[model samples]
Structures are given as structure tokens and as C-alpha cells.
Target: MKTVLKALVLLVVVVAVLAVLVFTWIGSRGISARDDPSGLETVVARTMRRLAIPRGDRNRQNPVPATEEVLAAGRAHYADHCAACHANDGSGETQIGLGLYPKPPDMRLSATQSLTDGELFYLIENGVRLTGMPGWSTGTPEGEEASWHLVHFIRHLPEITQAELELMQEMNPRPPAEIRQQIEAERFLQGGDPPPSAPHAH
Candidate 1:
């Protein structure tokens, strides 16, 4: 029994030492968002995230019922705010999503869909630290309701239709320049007016 205890203690000490060394080395080198985490790093980060959420929070139920109205509100909110990072179908393939370190997961997949509704709601409200996700909850009833609606929308991700995606694209934000150009083009096509030429660079 003593030998077993000693071996366990030694193993724990060795792991702790190695962890500190690795942390120091990484800090010295400077971590970059542009760099993808290693497989081991990814596993560790995910495990840490899972462990950080309280069991009570994870088990909490979504108070909002799944209804068409609720779902529609969620869809609109996601399209306007989240579509930049998480695509309409939750594929997370957009430029911003791809650029993020530890790039956003494909939410339509089991890894995301399998999470409890409460877990999703808490994440939406609390946001993950050191990641791009921002907590949407503004400490208001409206904000909390929005997050709950989003949880419903996330659950519907697997069943999102192509038509719905097309509709969402219309809601997604466009760059100011793109919006201006599109408006001018539409005017011209309607025989209203041709847009003035852009200023030439020196």
C-alpha cells in the first residue's frame, strides 16, 4: 500500500512539473490566435472548459418552450449577430470563424448538438473567456430571453433548410462599401441614376 501511494504521489508531482514547464515555455514563446492548437492542447482546453461549468448550471433547464415564434426570433438574432462567425447552418465555415483560434466548431455536428440545452444557454449568457464568443445577456430580462431563444435555434441547427439559409444571408450584415455599391447598382439597373466614380488613388 505504501509503494502504491508513493508511486501515485510521484506521478502527480512529475505531471505538475511538466505542466509548469510547458506553460512557461508557451508563455515565453507567446501564444498567437493565428496558430492552431495541437491535438493535445485542444483536448486539454476542451476538458478545462467542461470542468469549469458548474454541474448545476449544466443541468439547468431552458425555461422557454420550443415554439415557432421563439424559434423565429432566435433565427433572426443569430443571423444578424452570429452568422459572421457561425454560418447560417452552424457550419462555422465563414472567414471570421476560420480565422478564430481553435476555430468555432461545426455546430450541426453531434459534438455541439449533444450538449444540454442549459449548457448552451449558459454559454450564450456567460460567454467563454479568451475566446471570441461574447455573452449576449445584458443583465436584462430581454437579453436573457434572447439567449434562451438562441438555445432553441441551436437545437434546430441540424434541421436548418437551404431556403432558411438563403433568407438569413439577406439579414446578415454587409460592409458599408458593399451596401453602397449594391444600392448604386440597383439604381442604375432601374434606370434611375449611375453612381459617381470612386476617388482615384494618387
Candidate 2:
């Protein structure tokens, strides 16, 4: 009993020391979303994420079957909702994605593809803390089914075709400025006034 108590005390002391060191490092470097995480930080974050998932959830299988129709639905959903951050090719190269701290992963890569269907679904539903991802759960069976469909779509990302990418591009949401530009261009082509010039900064 005395030995167990000593071991527990030692563990607490070690953890406290590590915490202090980590905070000191952070204080010295300061926090910036622009900076990429270090190798150690990446490993720790991944480890924590893995540990946080319930075993049952990690082992659960995807209930939604991978069908052409299902895939098409997933593709459309991704293009409309996820493409802003994840990109049509799952490359995570969009301006918003690039600006995020730790940025989105390239979903076609092994780091993302290697995750089990359940893990992917859980992440989609629950989201990661302290990251750009948000929980998409709607607390409905339909919502869960959609998330399952997305898992299959994520699996298919590596094999996504160019035609499909073009389709998704058309479906991606355009910014208001881009929409205005398109409208102006269309008007000009119809012999209307040209687009207004940008105002100069004072």
C-alpha cells in the first residue's frame, strides 16, 4: 500500500513538471494560427484523439452501404457543405483551409484514409476540440445516416475522378464578391454598363 502511494505521488510530480515545461515553451514562442504544429505535437494530438474515442464507437461498422446513389448523394453534400474547407479533391487547399491553424488534412492521404469508418463518423458527428471541425450531429437518425454516407465518400476520395471534381466545383458555394463579378460580367456581355472600379484605399 505504501509503495502504491509513493508511485502515485511520483506520477503526479512528473505530470506537473511536464505541464510546467509545456506552458513555459508556449509562453516563450507565443501562439499563432499561422505556425505549423511540431512533429511531437502532431503525434500527441493524434494520440489524444484516438484515446478520446470510445472503443465501441471505434469498432462500430458503417451501416450505410456504398452504392452509386449513396456515393452521388455524399458527393453533392460534400461539395455543397464541406468543399469550402475540405476542397473537392479532399486536398484541403482552399484559402479558408490554409488559414486555419493546423489546417485541414488532405482526406485522400493515408493519415485520413487510414482511419476506420467508425472513427471517421465519430469525428464528423462529435468534432475535434480546439480545431476548426464542428460537430455536425443533428440528433436525428437521418443525420447519422448522412454522416455514414459521408464515411463511404471519404473512402472514395482517393479514387475520385476529374469529371466528378468538375461537378463538385460547380456545386461549391461562391463568395458574394465572386457572384457579383459573375453578374457584372454577364451584364457587360449583354451590352450593359461595365463593372464598377474598385475604390482606392485612403
Candidate 3:
């Protein structure tokens, strides 16, 4: 009993010292979204994320089957919703993606591809904390199924063809400015004056 108590006390002291050193390092480096996470930080964060997931969730199997229909649905959904950050090719090369600290992973890479289907689905539904990812759960069966479809699509990213990529580009959401330009161009073609531009912020 005395030995156990001593071991516990030593563990607490070691943890406290590590905490102090981490804080001191942070204080010296300062925090910035522009800075990439250190290797230690990346390992710690990934470990925490893995540990945070419930064992049942981590081991859960995908209920949806991988089929062309499901993959198409996932492709369209990803292009319209996730492409803004994840990119159509899952390259994570969009302007917003590049600016994010610890920017989104290239889904084709092993780091992302190696994750189990369950892990991918959980991350999509629940999202990672302290990152740009947002929980996409709609709390409905349909929503859950959509996320499952996405897991299959993520797995397919490595072999995505140019034809599929072209289809995704068509599905991607257009910026408001581009939409407005299209409207104005249509008006001009129909022999109408373009609408006046909204006042710009000073």
C-alpha cells in the first residue's frame, strides 16, 4: 500500500513538471494560427483525439454498402459542402484550407486513408475540437447515412479519376460575386441594364 502511494505521488509530480514545461514553451513561442503545430503537439493532439472516441464508436462498422449510387451521392455532397475547405480532390489546397493552422489533411494520403471507416464517420459527424472542422450531424438517419457514404468516398479518394473530379467541379458552390456576375451577364444578353452594384463598405 505504501509503495503504491509513493508511485502515485511520483506520477503526479512528473505530470505537474511536464505541464509547467509545456506552458513555459507556449508562453515563449506565443500562439498563432499561422504557425504549424510542433511534432510533439501533433502527436499529443492525435493521441487525445483517438483516446476521446468511445471504444464502441471506434469499432463501429459502416452500415451502408459501397456502391456507385452511394459514391455518387457522397461525391456530390462533398463537392457542394466540403470542397470549400477539403477541395474537390481532397487535396486541402483551397485558400481557406491553406490558411488554417494544421491545415486540413490531403485525404488521399495515408494519414487520412489509414483511419478506419468508423473513425472517419465519427470525425465527420462530431468534428475535431480546436480545429476548422465542424460537426455535420443532423441527428437524423438520413444524415447519418450521408456521413457513412462520405466514409466510402474518402476511401476512394486515392483512386479518384479526372472524370469524377470534373463532375465535382460542376457541383461545387459558386461564390456570391461570381453568381452576381452571371446574373448581370444574363441581363445584358436579354437586352436589360445590369443591376446597380451594392455600396461597398468604407
Worst 10 residues of 2 by lDDT: 193-202
Decide which is better by TM-score, 2 or 3: 3
Once superposed on the true structure, which residue ranges of model 2 sit more than 4 Å away at CA?
1-24, 180-202
Write candidate 1's Cα lDDT for 1-202 as tens digits.
9999999999999999999999999997677766677899788987888788899989988899999999999999999999999988899889899888888889999888888987898889988888888878899999999999999999999999888889898999989999988877876776667446643222
- Write the residue-wise lDDT of candidate 2 on 23-99 in tens digits: 99999888877677888988899999999999999998999889999999999988998989889999998988888
For 1-202, candidate 3 gives per-residue lDDT tens digits of 9999999999999999999999999898887666778899788988899999888898888899999999999999999989999999999999889888778889999988888888999999999988999999999999999999999999999999999999998899998999888877876777667446743222
| Local error of candidate 1 at residue 93 (angstroms) | 0.9
- Model 3 ranges with Cα > 4 A deviation: 1-28, 186-202
Q: TM-score for every candidate vs. truth?
A: 0.78, 0.78, 0.78
* Residue-pair clash count for candidate 2: 0
Clashing pairs in 2: none
Judged by whole-model lDDT over C-alpha atoms, candidate 1 comes out at 0.88
